[model samples]
Target: MKKIYSLLLLVVSCASFGQTIYTENMGTPTGTTLIPAYSTGTAPATFQNSSPIAYSGTADVRITSVSSGYTAASGGGNVLINAIAEYFQIDGINTSAYTSSGLQLSFGINTPTAVTNLLTVEVSTNGTTWTPVTYTPTGIGWTLATISSGIPSSTTLSIRFTSTTASQFRLDDIKVFNFDPSCTLALGTPTAACDAITFGLDTYTVTIPYTGGTSGAYTFTPSSGTVGGDNPATVPVGNIVVSGVTEGTGFTLHITKGSCTYDANAVAAIDCKPANALPFEDKFPYTVGSALGANQTWANANTGDSILAIAGSLSYTGVTSTGNSVSFVGTGAECQTPFTATTSADSGLYARFLINVTDYGTIADASTTYFATLTDGNPSNHKGRLFIKKSGTQYQLGLDAASTTTNFASTLFNVGDVVCVVLGYDFAGNTLKAWFNPTLATLTDATTPDLTSTPTTAITTLGGFLLRQDSATLTPTITVDELKITTTIAGLLGVSQNSAIAGLKIYPNPVSGGTLFIETAANAEKTITVYDVLGKQVLNTTTADSAVNVSSLHTGVYIVNITEEGKTASRKLVIK
Candidate 1:
């Protein structure tokens, strides 16, 4: 019983290897004969009438007749006869569909049980050369035989049967089967981008292509990074989404379904996170031919050159704003200024600039016309921008970051409109805030900001600030003036106190000489403190008399703080 069970298992295993590519039977011949047989090298099999032997059909393929080739019939109704030293061929069989498990050419043959070496079978790709195939016969009525060795790798193939010794042999029911397992797999492209503080979720969807194998659960494995949502997720028939992760590089998808494993191509990307700080400002107050004032200068951040000549189009326009303002024009033209910290402890920073769009000719919108930008050395590493654009008949203001843009407001200005733009950078929080068209004089008191964006990449350092119009034909004329960089909200908004300090008065407010007089209601001893525009305390002194000397102070705006009898008052002081 055990031997019978083992034999049954072998027969079942052989029967399971049935992915048939081609089949031929001698029934119902066509063309010039009753049966159609594929031929090669001038030898083709023919249909013969059933008589003595039939292996389940009334017709058999005959290679040659007794009168033509001097061979005896094998007496099988559905069989091919091969005489000694003569061969018959069956061509045009496609072997490309054969899988890695290999292929087998199967047929039923009837020959004398004693005739062990009756015939030899060979397979070929081109027909001139051939490889011999090993045949195993079951030795029963209409026995099943298979030739599985030396099968050509080519997609198109031919097989020949040749008789060796003088023996009657016939073939019928020719079939070819391949042992091909299912489930071939592949993956689609993944998603990538920079990190944003507000929206940090990056998503990628990969597809799996599979068919007709084991029906079971599928699993995915990443090469370098972890899968964002789920690990070893069930295989989706369509696609799967990988979400909720920071910037990653060199990610590859590996899929497994049952016994098959597939590895996709590796994908690489950049998700940067750098730090940033602020409290630096540029007013562009210089003469037409003078070098950019003191520590401030113009540079081409994109091209790495000093573009500070007085003869070029990016020089000071000599249009005085309290003194003068700078102008920029032409395509891809830009001017940048370096940042200097106003105080030693300054970390976060904000900047306010006045922009007057004088003439914009034939310019459509701000999609390509990047008028102002903040960067860290490389222009490609853009932190933020104030984009002036025209939408239809109305002009608009667009606040932009590395990955997203926010259209904040619409203005009434046609071509010539002066607008105030304020930008704040929070280095610790990785966020950018902006205010548009607010009065610069009272900006510190403005409660609401227009727009805000959180970036995924870190804005590590304030390398420079830039101004340009990236258009050639659309020559938009712009004038920039009254720029201020500061760390405090009061400094950024130009906060000033104009009222007298409780019956105390400072006469000749714009003190041009070396001496200025101070008067108090009760002639009390008072301590005076002066702060620069950047909120830096430059002078602190106590005075008992009515007069104070201010001879050494520079020509600029200063905030004066007066304290007397536990009372403190603040006011703006100017020196000329």
Candidate 2:
């Protein structure tokens, strides 16, 4: 075993303990890290003047005696005998390849004989100056000597090894430190996108490319980015289509002086997407569907579906009674308490109710609160034979039992009539119009109605209409098929065509217990596929169809992949 001890040196009668680690005669470091290169393995020789040993790259570091020198492996140069303190200052280490925020330097020593006269160990930056450290001796075996500090701070520095023999050190585990700063932004949480994620234009525009200490390229996907570990993308911006990423293992991202940079030992990447490339608010009308349950049938099966009345009555009638009051609740798709609407966006709501005209009468009572209540309704009030309780009292918008009311022309809806009762607010004219069977009898009001004395609240007490017959004593027995309430006119009008010039759509989206509908932006050769979470393809349809057979798929979360004209779009599909 080689025993390493401190050497005392005297300079001008001042005696101090000193250590000599390494000395290297150098060139600019050109080899890569951990890829078995010699450029990153050289260090400058050091001499202790009692002020703790340190040296620059110009200092001569001889690893073997010139008389019995060592060949520089299969590369160039030779290793000569001299103090080894300068070996600590290697070059070409990009430092960006280290994971997280720190660097690690690890190497081993091998000798023809059991050698152990090991002295001091150190690391440096710039391949010139170095920092010396003490090496503790363990048992007889040569274990890996690892020092984890001095990274980023000493990135340009190299490693130093001091010993009395010409043995070679098996170098491995070289790394960089402090790659992740203490002030890293906490903005990488995964979230579902609604409007495009805009980083407030001009917030972040530079891209850092990390290509060392790792082996592959990085890829940013629609929702996330993948590093060597396949984790979600932590890019600063929310939305942009960039490229120049390779797939590999062991990757890192770091920031310095307000600029981001990345490095990997075996990977290369460049920013392909531009900043703020696409930004536009989605203009689709707000939609809603009935609360899901086992015993419910929707006239329009779209969960976010809207029913439209194009000059006709849109009525919902249940074929049979399911013994349960078919009702709609204000729950969105996630079944989460629908996000409270701050404005019109939050007001996207609707209902689902059971309507049966057979054994029992269907009843709708929005009287969940006290300010509003259901009252005697007569359809003659609006050319229809239904009376409704409005605001503080019952106000009618129809003709006096004549049903001659209309929004456009002179179409009269008579008593005992049938019409689609559409209550929609016109944003353009700012009026609320109620259509009776499209146009037979229509009523228009110019003010937002106050259904409660607490005028600030909605008309919650107006929905439950008792379908009673015969003296009004017996509750009318009938089934109600569907009920929907929306803030947009188009949402209430269930039919709207897409006119955008993009090949993206979801079909049979308002899916029920049948085949799935797949719509395309244009007719072209496309690849329609469905995948589960485990990267397994559940369904693969290669033809072009507006609607596809999905009755064979089991109910669960499915990702529908549509590839047309080299553009791809994916949507989530649910089956119930």
Candidate 3:
């Protein structure tokens, strides 16, 4: 024998965040004609104060039994015999306010027998071609249905309930309410600080606009770093401190309430430190045709192939203050140098270089193209990277570290702009900072860092410093000069002027015959030292005579330091 199932549609008025467009209880006097806003069919049901059964209120509408219009079934269960078609519609329903999830249509039903083909709920705007609504309950003890078929676009919408079986059917407490099962999450601005520095513990606050779900807790996940100070199991919508964040770290807040969920993302802010002295400097004073072989200080001549050439060329022109500068065009052209002070315990180091970007080729969004990098030879230990790429029409500076990239400052760089870039690492804080277009005279700390990375694991030892174009498609022409790496800021800017050596003068500033004449105060023991542009000590001598032979030195710019009676002064010496 085949099993039979009966459905009882039960609807109740319930409070919800969404607005209720329409509702009806059918609590009218007995023997009153059941008149909806609109009606159809030759014969319709009448409103009865007491029906076969009332789920809630005192009255309901009933479909009377029919005799002849029923149809026989093919499969041979209980045939739908004497089926009567009737439609009672409530009009003037504006469904435009409904969200993409649609609204709920509910009503109470009282059926006497287990009839398979008994009733069907439908809706339409023109009242001619109706759409059927599936009977799916969403609330407890209530027969719920959704208008998932989408309500008609007309203002005069109508909902009709059709009964087809001979069994009498009753409906009451019809309601149309919004079914919004989603929430809105808002995480406001979060406070941030440098590593180890205290500022309210870098706490942040968040709030949920609608918390109407079963899940009470929320989870905070960082994109590239870790977060702490709040219980992950039962995090609420309030102040929660964040930690272990590095530069470019983004956070996502996840919340689940009942059957709904919401999420939001935000970034943390950190401050940058100033530049310090470096152990190496390079001015690229080699002539145009000179071979770019490895020098005493540099690890390699120049590596990588140019995009437009078969081999990378370090031969470049357009000298600025110095006699020469290195040019990199196309892709992969680069220069690298090795330094012994690569350990994190070196405290701090600064690397500064002057660059003139003549072109910034077509670039796609989020595509990284590097201009300079400091690495520890090990691919895993990428100390820091400085990059500039196109973001829309403007070029922006970015810093890459700890496996994340972050853009800093609103200042945009364009083609033909000559600027100095200073990259520094602070071992004390384990952070990286950068400055763009800094004043070379004073080497003042960039008021605001172009970019800064959060405290990370200290790079114990560095292998080499590199300047290259990492993008294949980016064919930018850049001239780099005056590259310097020092451990103190004053060393890069200039030594302080000494008043005791004011009367001393160096004659034949641009000496050609390799003979330098120095005029010093009488009866003073003076010590002189000459350093190449690379900060390499080339010549040192102590003399009472004024004339010094420099024939052994090459043609270039050098810094001459003179010390007399505990007073020191520095002068630039140009060899021709």
- Residues 1-576, candidate 1: write the lDDT tens digits: 000000000011122144445555443221222122322111212322222211222123443321111111122234444456655566666778555346767676776556475678887787768878887665634566766656665665777777775556766656666643454332333344333321122333222232222345667665544444322334333343343333423355555655444444324332232222233333332334442311113434332112222221122222113334565554533555545433224455677777766666566664434577776655556677766655554466667665335545545555566677777777766767787766555555344777777767757765556676465454366767756556666766433212224577887789998676777786677777676665445676777787878787899987676655434455678999
Please say which candidate is ahead in TM-score: 1 or 2. 1
Q: Which regions in candidate 2 have their CA more than 4 angstroms from the true location? A: 1-327, 330-419, 436-521, 524-576
Tell me the tens digit of each residue's lDDT in model 2 across 1-576: 111112111110000001112222222222222212432243211121112223223223233322111111111112222335423334544444343235444333222245454545655555556577544443333343445455444334455555444344332222233323322222121111112111111111112222111222333321123223222244433322222222111122321222223221111111111111111111111111222211001111112211211111114332111111222212111101111122232332222122222321222221111100111121111111222311222122221112122212123332223223443332333222344343311222322232101112232221121221221222222223323333443343332112222745675664676687666557765566665543245677666666777777777776566555433445667876
**TM agreement with the true structure for every prediction:** 0.34, 0.22, 0.38
**Candidate 1 weakest ten by summed lDDT:** 1-10
Which regions of candidate 1 deviate over 4 angstroms?
1-281, 289-296, 302-321, 341-347, 365-368, 377-380, 403-408, 439-446, 473-475, 493-576
Deviation from native of the Cα of residue 216 in model 3, angstroms: 88
Greater lDDT among 1 and 3 belongs to 1
Error of 3 at 82 (Å): 72
Q: Give the poorly placed runs of model 3, Cα more than 4 Å off.
A: 1-279, 289-294, 301-303, 306-320, 342-344, 362-366, 377-381, 402-404, 439-447, 496-576
Taken over the whole model, the C-alpha lDDT of each candidate is 0.51, 0.30, 0.50
Question: What lDDT score goes with residue 323 in model 3?
Answer: 35
Please state the error at residue 302 of candidate 1 in Å.
5.2
